[model samples]
Target: MNHTIPLALSIAGTDPTGGAGIQADLKTFQEREVYGMSVITSVVAQNTIGVQDVHHIPLDFIESQLKSVLSDLPPHSVKTGMIATPEMMEMIAAYLRNQSIPYVLDPVMVAKSGHALMDPASQDIVREALVPLATIVTPNIPEAEILVDFQIQDLYDAQRAAKVLVEELGAEAAVVKGGHLKGEAVDILYVNNRFYTFPSIRTNTKHTHGTGCTFSAVLAAELAKQKSIVEAVSIAKKFITDAIRYTLNIGNGNGPTNHWGYRLKNIPTVKGENHHV
Candidate 1:
């Protein structure tokens, strides 16, 4: 039998812990039935507790890597995370400018261990160069604040931030994640002048490393499968919720979410039917 599988790519840094960055993205992509590819932008010596050091790949080498993959086997969708410098972001933007694919941007600024992953001065370049090139920009509360230059104190603030990301920052769509907010975890999406809100019950656990990367990766995978932005976001939300609910209790500090949790759980084969795993 001959068949074609959807391909998705992650252009990001490496997390040796296997809980975040390109590792998390590839895992999530495979879980969603999409073939995954990667272009390493930086290498980080990191663990669940914190990042100890980082080695950024040279700008020309980064471009060469992009060309190597893009020229030969272009992916159906692309997701980016942990691009540490403005120069790197600019080069990536140039490469992605002509490609017509679903581009999901995870503005990963800080790690779970309170380590900064991006340069402070690169925020503007990301907003101007990368954000506009993104088909969808996924930003958490703090990342949204940096992009929109406003404090996101509540749901209303998140909604405003999503709009600003779409209108002001030039992203075709925006997702303002509410994980940092108290109570239920909610995410607001703004696209085509419409707003959609997804809310899920919060899970009580410290094993929540790589959540942002997982969420955006799932979105990219779904997009690679030709799912609409709204549908992709909805499914990605559920995927992350289940992944968090069944988090892997490894490491002394925050651990990684279970990437295959959704598939392992008992799900209804038919609507209105109950099943157990």
Candidate 2:
């Protein structure tokens, strides 16, 4: 007997350390019970400490990889991270224009170590050509500033930015992650003309290398199961929070979150969320 499973695709860079990017994405997909596919945009030589080097894949090959998967597997949901260039963003944008499945866009700009992952100019293309196609846009505060063109200094600012991503940039919804901020790990979501506050206790640890990639990957996986945007993001929040809480202390510097931590016994996954309308 054969079993049908939800399929998810991640188009992004590679983290050789297995902490972030394609590796993190695949881990989250597998953990979420989704079949995972990947299209690598660049090969990055990065570890817990910092990025050592990067070799971008040829644009033609990138497109070829996309075509190979889209024509064959055709994922139930799709997501993107570190689509580094204007040309690449445009290419992906063209393919996604007609996509009806859930598309979670993690606007990856800089690495956790402050290495630039995307071209600074690609911000315009991401706003103009890509964000609108997103089923949901997940941006940490820094990325939110670039996409929304303002400083997000606090929760209100994050709330405003989340609203801008959906109302102004035309994303179906947006979640402005507040990891860069102080206090509780509060993420503000704006969708369907309302706001939601998902707060979980901040783990005092440095093993959060691939938090964004893993979080958005979970969103894609949950959405592939046909869960609503709020439900998907809520689940993503719990997964990332739990993953961070357990803390995988493998690397020397900012290490990776525990991909399987959420499944750990006696781990109080996440707290309840609050609504804001």
Candidate 3:
């Protein structure tokens, strides 16, 4: 009997704490019932408190790692996080430009402890070489603001930025996370020329270490299983909400999200609305 599971690949940095970046992505893929593969871009010496140091893999080695997994495993979907340099972005983009599978981009710029993971000078390169290749780009408030080059004060701004990510930057869709907003955490998604909102009651916890990576990874996993775009986002949203609600307090500072939180009962149902704004 030949049995196979959907495979999802993550190209990102590594976290020794097993919270964010490649580790978080792999955890998400596993919990979502997909086989996970990884290509490490950077080795981060960081824990919950903050990032201490980072060692970027050589570009040639990075390319080799990419080819090793992508060539043989051939994931059904792929996502990237912590693309620190322009050269790394371009190399990954070149390989993904023609792949028909879903490509989820988590624009991981800063860590939970306010450490900069990406180079400041590489923003322009990211927009030009990466944002366009994303089937869907997931950006929290700060990242979204940077991508759209505007201040986002409310849901309207988020919707506008989401549209910009799709219409102006050429992503198939965009999710402008509203975590920075002061009310219910409402994430707006722009896809198929329409806007949709997925709102969850704010979980007042500092353990949202890998929320972004986990969200995007679940999106990729669901897509690899052949779920529709809307379906995938819906699942991803619910998964993250639970993970955040029941966060893990392992590290001294902002801890990691509970990857298995979805297993718990009575996860409040978060509904999404379709809007024409």
Candidate 4:
């Protein structure tokens, strides 16, 4: 009997719309065959349209939640997203100091809806407190730009930025996703003294609501299963690609990708059809 269940935890914000944040993370975890746990840092009033409001959970409550979960059911891997303030970063970093679990940091600075998610004052706190502790930092084009105070216009620039992030910012590894780039979506991961690229044809749709959360959460889930960083990132790239291809039109502004895309494809159907609904 296979009693080996990988446990993954996500420390992030709550998305009331169930399109991103903790909701997306949990979906990715389940998709990757992992048990998911969550410690929410903030509750967001949002829809496919945009984020209307955000309420930060108290630092003490965040601490208590982490303690409760970590004490009883320690996760094999953990990932962080959308920490709202400097206090939240400090609180999480302090708690992480005691544990040596592998962690992925999704530096969620700005929402796809064009709203600022992280406080500008908290950038330094996250860099000093969270980045160094993380096993890998997954930052998209804009987030990577913010992290190093530079612009990434192409894959060459992304490679340069990844090195800078690891050397200058003290991150163990960095993946600069090029979803915002033109043409094919080329994500670059810098690790083990090499750069690996995962390229996918850009989907011509607006169902990218949870791409970041899903990618980072899938990385965490892969790590929880003892997969190497490079292997984990490769798997996550395929996961996101298929997910975007199977996107469901959920809202007017932008829809959400289907986390169960693979499962949906696997279900038995009448033999005559060549396409899935």
- Per lDDT, the best of the predicted structures is 2
Q: Write the per-residue lDDT of candidate 2 for residues 87-151, one digit (tens) a residue.
A: 99999899888678889999988667565556657778888988999999999988899899899
Whole-model lDDT, candidate 3?
0.88
- Quantify all predictions' global Cα lDDT against the true fold: 0.87, 0.89, 0.88, 0.84
Question: Which residue segments of model 4 deviate by more than 4 Å?
Answer: 1-4, 264-277
Clash-forming residue pairs, model 2: none
| TM-score between model 2 and native | 0.95
lDDT of 4 by residue, 32-120 (tens): 98999999999999888888898988888998999889888889999999888887888888887787889999998877855566667
Please state every model's RMSD to the true fold in angstroms: 5.0, 1.9, 1.7, 6.4
Listed in order, each prediction's TM-score against the native is 0.93, 0.95, 0.96, 0.92
Per TM-score, the best of the predicted structures is 3
Worst 10 residues of 2 by lDDT: 265-274
lDDT of candidate 1 over 1-277, digit per residue (tens):
2227888999999989899999999999989999999999999998888778999999999889898888878899999998888889888998889889999999987655555556668988888899999999999998898889989999889989998888888999999999999988988888888888888878899989999999999999999999988888888988898888887789878888999988778642211111221
| Residue 186 lDDT (model 1) | 87
Candidate 2 lDDT (Cα, 0 to 1): 0.89
